[model samples]
Target: MNLTERLAAQPMSNPRADRVKDVAGLAGRSARSKRGLFLAEGPQNAREALARHLESPCVDAVYVTEDALGRHPDIAALLERVAGDRSVFVRLVTREVLAAMSDAVTPQGVVVVCPSLDVAAEEVLAAGPRLVAVLARVQDPGNAGTVLRAADAAGADAVVLTAGSVDVYNPKTVRSTAGSLFHLPVVVGADLPELLRAAREAGCGVLAADGHGDVDLDRLQDASAARAAGAEGVDAVYDLARPTVWLFGNEAQGLSAQEKALADHRVAVPVHGRAESLNVGTAATVCLYASARAQRRGADRP
Candidate 1:
């Protein structure tokens, strides 16, 4: 019940102990992909997970070292409150072992293992007239996380990543989110066509970003009919509050011709500076925020 008892009670070993040989081993898609689980490392993410546990209990385990205990005594109180919950597991490790299991130069002395959500197309579709980001094979971990974080900050309902997008649960991605991951629903391993179909069915418009698109993002903001919705039957209105998926493609190739064809509108972010183009993540942020602002404007309209 007390802080001292809680700290002393953290399990040091289990009846059936499983030793993780290397932190890098858990980085692969196969292990994480198969288990539908991922690791969140560092003080920030671990602390965020603890905060979530305090709020509604979203994580499975809190693994830490003595150094972490020394630094963050508050976590002991958090662990004590929810430790009896079936999903909550707490463990303490040696500093050397913690260092081996950490990816950072300076390990924050704590990490969390949590369930990776297998978001359904139906759920995404059900969020009608919602703002969503569809990441198509975004490779960079930081970029992918930034996009998700931005989407959440902009009030996008959810983010659906195509089959090839970077792992949303990567340590760097989790860190970059800065706890926005907890604030939004992120669907990974979604099929592009199925997602597109859901968007259409839900009366959501798909806006694919392309450097060559005839329509500019500003036009969409103004609610102007610069580009007509395609024959796919998606909504012509680029209403962010309505179901909308802002499609962002790979960093190197951009959106494929077929992918662009599926979009109800293809809009480009106008750039005046010498930069060739915006990064996929940056471009996504600009587009998502614009939709968020426009959606707010629409809400305020009448």
Candidate 2:
């Protein structure tokens, strides 16, 4: 007699259910922004979100077809309860229409509209000793998404994209996050100087990556080692677990001289390959993982 039982027992007729086919045609970011809503698609992620947050009634609207109901039995009940409201609809979309509506190439035949979490920079930093990846002017959506995934995997406190970075909500970028977008705090429209000042005030050290730097990032094992080196103007060098910010710059030009000057220290990943430099995203993942390694070492030390 529940929603899933109802879905399983009921008869189906409507092929093109009452749902928005072209989500892009529905509204702009301002509308989604003002209403605190964003699109969620695919069966696996949809079911996960429903299982985790929908039971609390946080889910606003859900669009599912009869086929999706049969395929995703786990979420059928949850979807039915949420979809009962007029605001929610179980729409039947043609595979072609769903494909167009979906950001992913292979439409999962299910999608939902839900609330977005507004994550603040200070709140994220306050969570603990921060590991923040500050991405400056990174235009490539894939690169941006890869950096976000890396930040999530590296257990970063937050990821901040300064002005000029690709849109975080762009379907391509969002699709590339692979569900990490939901797990971490992402702050866009960052003010570099303000962030730097705040990190410094919070006792966090800032390290800017440059192909040309005073020291290789692989060298600094811990805060004590960095401090002992006593490199002039290098501040406390870098302790990745000590509320640190890692600055990655544009893909083509790398870090600008002005941006480079803002860091307390410049560090570079040592290269042994034939290539002169790592791709922006590859370099970022390596840098973030290095921080993770250093932090693990710090934690293990008695």
Candidate 3:
């Protein structure tokens, strides 16, 4: 029988229980880093965390209020699916206890204690990623998380958060990802230049998304067509279909001259509207999808 079919061996009813305090403390970075465990709250986050449990086996424990199992059949089904796993313990938690363990204003009655999702920059690069997103000193959790989701939607191989960037494990950041955090390998706290070096060594053309760039994104999109047309001098530009790593800078400051220059091309998202400019999140979506589309079209180019 699956875990859903069976009741948890123990029931945790105290909101001020010692275990509740310990789990709630995971909101802090030091606690998470030292303990090598983090909290995943809500039905969505817990479900995704459960999905990747086998690969990393990060799910240490799961707590669900009775209401949760009844309200969210999907979550109940997921618990049943992984019931045989000895590493993760599924238990019945009081609604108050679930609220105490979560940072959300309205707790979803489902929470998971998981390990930090950190991977070595070298490990992901070893796979020869076709697409990567490098977040350099991105302080805003929303922007950072949105970029990750966009990267995943664009089929990026992995995401690297530079040393000065916001914590990928921050509760707001984790929630902002909408569960995409579990969908791909995310490398955090790495030296930006070294990560760039690894991507370049893997034969990826690193493009920095700078609004004031000399080359527009539309031009880069035309490179594949130019290559097929036997056009003159157009081959000098980047081929988006080839392996690529996109470097996006901080929300307010954007990239410095040196950082922009490091990339094979400094790219700008074309703005036809009267609006001033696109934020980092919108810009990344535009750039990444542009690459995805270019690579898709390049495959069919005669």
Candidate 4:
């Protein structure tokens, strides 16, 4: 039977059900680790997860309120498409049940339980990616998710969160991704030094985003632009068009000396407005887009 038929047959009304508690337990790291499952709360996240389910069947089940289904026709349509698939379950729940299953303050009426999506660092490096973002010791869940979203927007091949970083599956981080979590490959619990070594071996130049660094981002872009335009006698410091891995450090302390040492060069994003500094997410977006522009421009060159 399809989702609509199943919903009419038996709606989930109890907030205190064992099944509801099992889904809610995913908010805790220990429970998520044990079950290898995570919650994708809200319509935005649920839509993305459902779309991915159509592609690869990563979603385990979907729980939603009738009001939410009416409001988001796209989500409802996607759920109908996957309704017949035995691997994915769809259930209609009360608002109270959805709230009990969500970690958000104001739960958005839809939630999906999905398996962990992180890939191994080796697998990503083996793909010969041209652009990568590495989060080293980034502790804030919001910062981590924002950087991942930025990387996805910048068309990065993958994002790696090192061992000391926040859990990629943290509900705040997952929500912060705003559906970008399912858009790209992410590596979690990676060793910083080892991943750097692998990236270097894969022919990627490692650059660290440092606020106090000597290598200026503006100069690199200018050099890249000059080279792309076939300017003569333009000696570039480091080619932004080359395959690169950008290391973004912690929100509070930035990259430690040891982490900085692992990169080919430390690049500073110029600040002309006299603001203290760019947050990690903003800095990562600027740096990733810089490389993306340079790379695309280079690809267009004769």
Best by TM-score, which number?
4
Write one digit per residue (lDDT tens) for candidate 4, span 1-302: 77879879656889999999999999999999999999998888998898888888789989999899999999989988999899898899999899999999999999999999999999999999999999998999999999999999999999999997999999999999999999989999999998989998999999999999889999999999999999988786799999999999999999999999989899999999989999999999999999999999999888
**TM, every model:** 0.85, 0.78, 0.93, 0.98
- The sequence of per-residue lDDT tens digits that candidate 2 reaches over residues 149-176 is 8888998878888977776766566656
Candidate 4: regions farther than 4 A off: none
Provide the overall lDDT of each model, using Cα atoms, as 2-decimal numbers. Answer: 0.75, 0.70, 0.85, 0.93
How many clashes does the backbone of model 3 have?
Answer: 0
- Where model 1 places Cα greater than 4 Å from the true spot, the runs are 1-6, 9-17, 22-24, 54-57, 69-77, 222-242
Model 3: lDDT equals 0.85
Candidate 3: give its CA RMSD in angstroms: 2.1
Tens-digit lDDT string for candidate 1 (1-302): 44344457754443223444433455666877777677778776776777776786688766787778778867666766776675666677666666666666677888777777546878767757468888998888988888988998888889888887888887778778877787777788888998898788888888898888888777566552222221233343455444568899999999999889989888899887989999987899899888777666656553
Best by lDDT: 4
RMSD of every candidate to native, in Å, equals 5.1, 4.7, 2.1, 0.9
Residue 15 accuracy (lDDT) in model 4:
95
Residue-level lDDT for 159 in candidate 1: 86
Candidate 2's C-alpha lDDT?
Answer: 0.70
Residue 109 of model 3 has an lDDT of 85
Cα error, residue 166 of model 2, in Å, equals 1.3
